[model samples]
Target: MQGTILLTGATGFVGGAILKRLHLEKKRSVVAVVRDSSKVILENVPKVCIEQFDGSTQWEQRLDGLDVVIHAAARVHVMNDVEDDPLAAFRNVNVEGTLNLARQAAAAGVRRFIFISSIKVNGEGTAPGSAYVADDVPAPMDPYGVSKMEAELGLRQLSLITTMEVVIVRPVLVYGPGVKANFLNMMRWLDKGFPLPFGAIHNKRSLVALDNLVDLILTCIDHPAAANQAFLVSDGEDLSTTQLLSRMGKALNAPRRLIPVPSWLLEGGAALLGKKALSQRLCGSLQVDITKTRNLLGWAPPLSVDEALAITAKYFREHH
Candidate 1:
């Protein structure tokens, strides 16, 4: 904790929040690695700009004298990815690039390499009550998940042969201020009073607030128990789609107009429209068991679901 910390993806949602927290803690020995320095608004934080972040990128000078390297930069999962070879694209950056950085960091005598992985590495969803634990066998379904899974594997292998400790943190769907895509759209629909068909969605999902995730990452930075270990993180609470929407409605002061559409009917309709994956995400269960995370590192999500939801809603209303 006394030495310099190098953080990647400083402009991203999770990374930005971590950078802000580090800044608030008045840690001046932090170096932010980014593709665009102008996008990073945190003052007094040194930055090293790299135009590209693939396997060939060099990090010798950047990793020098660094105690911790938080690798948050990756080709994130997106809906309907347009890449001709999505797996290759993700592997190029997520796997090869990550391993490349880890190799260099180890050679440079970096103490620890913390990776921000995704729960997709544990597969898409869980049964009604069962949840994904830290040691679950890898069952990544898509190219992105496969890439993250590969990255985790490569990091673990590298750690076995090197002195640098590796920590992998796999978080569930993360949402907070400045969230976009589906979560934002859900807020929009709620604000507009659109009648959603999620009233009957009894499936539970585990989500992490940006604050909670940042706290976990920071905790992993120096915790001895976290070294060479993978963690499954969540808000420690699972909510049904209906419950999530109802909470959002309360946070936004918006009327809930959800209709009790049968889950089978919704799935069938979505399959007919070629939106089966989207429907599964909206109406499926993807819970994670964080007991290992808690017992090992004594870590618990510092923010409640409703508290984080309200913060996210407040930001949404103020900004949009």
Candidate 2:
């Protein structure tokens, strides 16, 4: 049976990945709430309607007979000045706009509402030798995480008050083809035959692939176990920074020469030069336990870390 789905962030990296997958499946009719629906990311799939990012889209009328709503838009940044008002900007889009849509969906009797959140809602970085499970307390640290946490709380609260189902997905450092910024920088360095100075730094981190995340999102669309549940998601595999970079390099046909840099020295330099954010990226343990997501939803991340890396490498190879 063909169903109707409303997807925000449909043009973004992770969301675009989801849209690419959805394009292949003819089972559902997907309508995206885009900043620009005419600016197509994928061709010959379908037309994206509703050309805005706010709650004023009269979504209540449009959401009529919809099966699911995927809220994947949010304010994203690795670092921000504390003095600046990122929260206000995010709230306008993330918090209030999200609730507005969810409320409209609930009013229209939509079946499920899926939210794409971040592990930053749990903690900035996973503690050493420990991973966050579904039951762990949420202690959001930054403005972005705090806002996401608040949105999660709002969704949970709304679910309690309404008949709408809510499913939340937390992705950790999702990397695949078409990735940008820090992850891309790492790939670029590897592409140029530069070895990352991260060898021998054994810190485990969890990551989700673009394809795997799409699979999970589709699964969550109708999965009964996702109702009113907050689950931590990972690739079901953890690797050190060096290992991840190495796999990426191999996938790109780039040389893999890793230099052993002491973790302490690297971290110390970052801390000294206001580069702590980069340090966290280079050396941090951010593992998440996906046991609950698997047990409850009967779903598993489809791609192995290596498989995802290879795909990303291939993407760079083909594109470059």
Candidate 3:
């Protein structure tokens, strides 16, 4: 046995993908914590041990004997405006829960603490020509991003007083089969073969595939460079929004049905609805240079965009 790896959110999109790979490549034991794990979370990963650990419970015992902890659990929603307070709800889980677990992991002799933070922590929306690097100051606009930023800061502070190595991975829109939210909406559109006018819009954005991110996370658990460091990871290949959509359609076996709508028209429409910031999120370039990660850890993104998209499409076809 290569010791135990405790995974929070093991049944989640990114967490499940990582857990799936860990059992395949390594001899270590993985303890997957889930609220209500489905059969798929247990399938294929024969070596994974299951644990019921919601964020509400105390974490000291849960982290015991674990060599590494990959925290992937969070309240991931686009917007939350409840009667009381929206930001408070996210803060309770994303910020408080994360720090609470990290404190326990540190007490339990956990070697590494891998945090699955979002690029939203850097900023919710993008500005023109404002591609950020790892060192740039965060400007999280939304509640989710704000919570994540607080978690990162808290982890850094925790590291000052503990032996647990903290590694934060800030990933931009992660897409693959079983993807949710707007990315999934785009698929429904492409599945119908609806024509889109995004062909002319040229905006480069960085993205991480399931496989690439999973591999990087495993590597970060013990890699010397990843100790007490943050990384902005992608597939190492930058693509314009148009290119991404075209590739996505091709992967799904749908032909590119792009019309040429003026970028200005879309921007104007977005501005009118007070969605200009969101529009930037959709069409703006938030390119991240993974050069530091590559140089420091000697790691690279495993799958190209085409390869990743094909895997996603294949999975979608098998189930649907």
lDDT tens string, model 3, 1-320? Answer: 78789888877899888887887876788877776544456654432333423356576466778899899878785632563766888888889888888988898899999999988888754455567677679888888889899999999999989998899999988988788777777777887899987877887788889888888888898788899999888898878778888988998998789887777787888899988866786667788878888899999888888999999888777876
Higher-scoring candidate on TM-score, 2 or 3: 2
- For model 3, name the residue pairs that clash: none
- The sequence of per-residue lDDT tens digits that candidate 1 reaches over residues 1-320 is 48888999988999889899988887537888889756745878888898899999988688888899999999999989999999999999999999999999999999999999999999999999899999999999999999999999999999999999999999999999999999999999999999999898899999999999999999998889999999999999999999999999999999999899988899999999999999998888999999999999999899999999999999999999
Task: Give lDDT tens digits, candidate 2, residues 95-174.
Answer: 77788888889999988999998888888787789998876789888777887888888899999999999998888888
In candidate 2, how many clashes are counted? 0
Task: Name the better of 1 and 3 by TM-score.
Answer: 1
Regions of candidate 1 where Cα sits further than 4 Å from its true position: none
Give the distance in Å from residue 250's predicted Cα in candidate 1 to where it truly belongs. 0.3
Please report how far candidate 1 places residue 126 from its true position, in Å: 0.7
Please provide the root mean square deviation of candidate 3 (C-alpha atoms, Å).
Answer: 2.6
